[model samples]
Target chain A: EPEVTQTPSHQVTQMGQEVILRCVPISNHLYFYWYRQILGQKVEFLVSFYNNEISEKSEIFDDQFSVERPDGSNFTLKIRSTKLEDSAMYFCASTPDEKLFFGSGTQLSVL
Target chain B: GIQVEQSPPDLILQEGANSTLRCNFSDSVNNLQWFHQNPWGQLINLFYIPSGTKQNGRLSATTVATERYSLLYISSSQTTDSGVYFCAVASDSWGKLQFGAGTQVVVTP
Candidate 1:
């Protein structure tokens, strides 16, 4: 079974530093998304990308955050300046249509 | 924006016991899915039932889209089933999913 693969299973960064989380979505999926779950909280959608452009984003996905599908295979989420509150498990998902599949997730920790 | 609510914030089941989980949404949805977040923080897809019913092994799910609610049934539970089960819904074909707080399950053997 093909699955979304995310790199850097765990990332540790200092507050105000930059971090980029990478993902390789299922080969033929058309829609891609980034979601985060704060410790002990529900998962929250951050942003969605399609056709190499952002389709929708939540308020939590503010200017500090950006996503890119550079090279058509790798999807990356960059946070320009991390904060302590950014410590959470970030998930990457892709869907051919209605059934969405999620990656193992990248745990980001900002000190 | 749609609201999703899950019942019984937490549940504890002994091995071989059966349990049911419920999820309610505020409005109509085009897509509904269930996920299990394990202790390792991996979100595992369990079901994608927007309507009707489907069964896989000892697990099954039913969604009444008109009533804006869904149910997940787990039979003969095991310790591996201990995790947080999340229900997510999307109003549009490719919209972002709205996830509920999730029901934490602890299946003790």
Candidate 2:
């Protein structure tokens, strides 16, 4: 089965520094998404991308957060000036249909 | 946004036991899925059942869309099955999934 791949299994960054999370979605999948889970909390959707544009985003996905598919295969999420609260496990997901497939996740810690 | 409620926030079972986890949603949904988050925090898709029943190995899931609820049953549980089980639903076509708080399960030997 094809799966989404995320790089930097663990990332440590200083508060107010910039960090980019990378994901390589399944080749043929069209819809891509990013979700996050703070330790002990439920997973929350951040943004959804389709056809090179954002379809929908949550309030948590504010000005500081941005997503881009720079190339056809790589989907990246950039956080400018990270805050301590940004520490969490970020998951990248993709789907050809309604059923989504998720990557292992990238654990980000902001100090 | 839809309201999602999961019962018995946590559960513990001895290996070889059976258990059921419940998920209730407030509105109609187009997609419903169950996922298991392992110790490493990887979300593994277990099922995608918006309605009716489906089974895989010792695991099964039934979604009663009319009742707005879903149930996941694990039979002959093993320590490997220990993890946090989550139920998520998408109310719209190709929409974001709203997740439940999840039921944390611990299977002991």
Candidate 3:
């Protein structure tokens, strides 16, 4: 079965540095999303992207966060300046309709 | 935002036993899905039953949208079935999913 794929399974960055997490959603899927889960916490939605625009975002997705579908296959999330609290597992998901496919996730660590 | 509650936060079952997990939502939903998060932390799609019933092997799910609840049944449980089961719901307007805390199941031989 076709699945969502993410790059840089794990990343470590300085507190004031930038990081970009990349994902390649299923080829035919139309909607894409970014979600994060802090250790021992529930998964939280960050933003949803469709038609090259952000459909919705949460409060946590503030000024420092941005998402882009620079190409037909690549979707990415960039954080301008990482904070210690930003350490978590970031998941990328795509849906052809109601069923969403999630990637293995990228573990982001900020120090 | 919708509220989702899952029952029996933790479960323990012996091999060959059966179990049923429940998910309750605070509002009407157009999409409801059940997923199993394996030991490696990968979310495995189990069923996308927005309403009615569907079955696959030893697993089955039923959703009564009007009643605002869904149930997942696991029969002939195995050690491989030990993991976290998550129930997610999307409201009638958008596809954004709000997930329940999940139930952790441990099946022993």
**Candidate order (DockQ):** 1, 2, 3
True contacts kept of each: 0.93, 0.76, 0.38
Model 2 C-alpha lDDT versus the unseen true structure: 0.96
TM-score of each: 0.98, 0.98, 0.97
Query: Any runs in candidate 2 off by more than 4 Å, and if so which?
Result: none
Interface RMSD of each: 0.7, 0.7, 1.5
lDDT of 3: 0.93
Q: Looking at the true structure's interface, with contacts defined as alpha carbon pairs within 8 Å between chains A and B, what fraction does model 2 recover? A: 0.76
Per-candidate DockQ values are 0.91, 0.85, 0.60
For candidate 3, what is the total of clashing residue pairs? Answer: 0
Q: How close is chain A of candidate 2 to the true chain A, as a TM-score?
A: 0.99
Could you give candidate 3's per-residue lDDT for residues A25-92 as a string of tens digits? 99999999998988877788899999999999999999999999998999999999999999999999
Greater-DockQ candidate between 1 and 2: 1
lDDT tens digits, residues B6-109, model 3? 99999999999999999999999999999998888778889998899999999999999999999999999999999999999988535678999999999999
Complex DockQ, candidate 2: 0.85
User: Which regions of candidate 1 deviate over 4 angstroms?
Assistant: none
* Better model by TM-score: candidate 2 vs candidate 3: 2
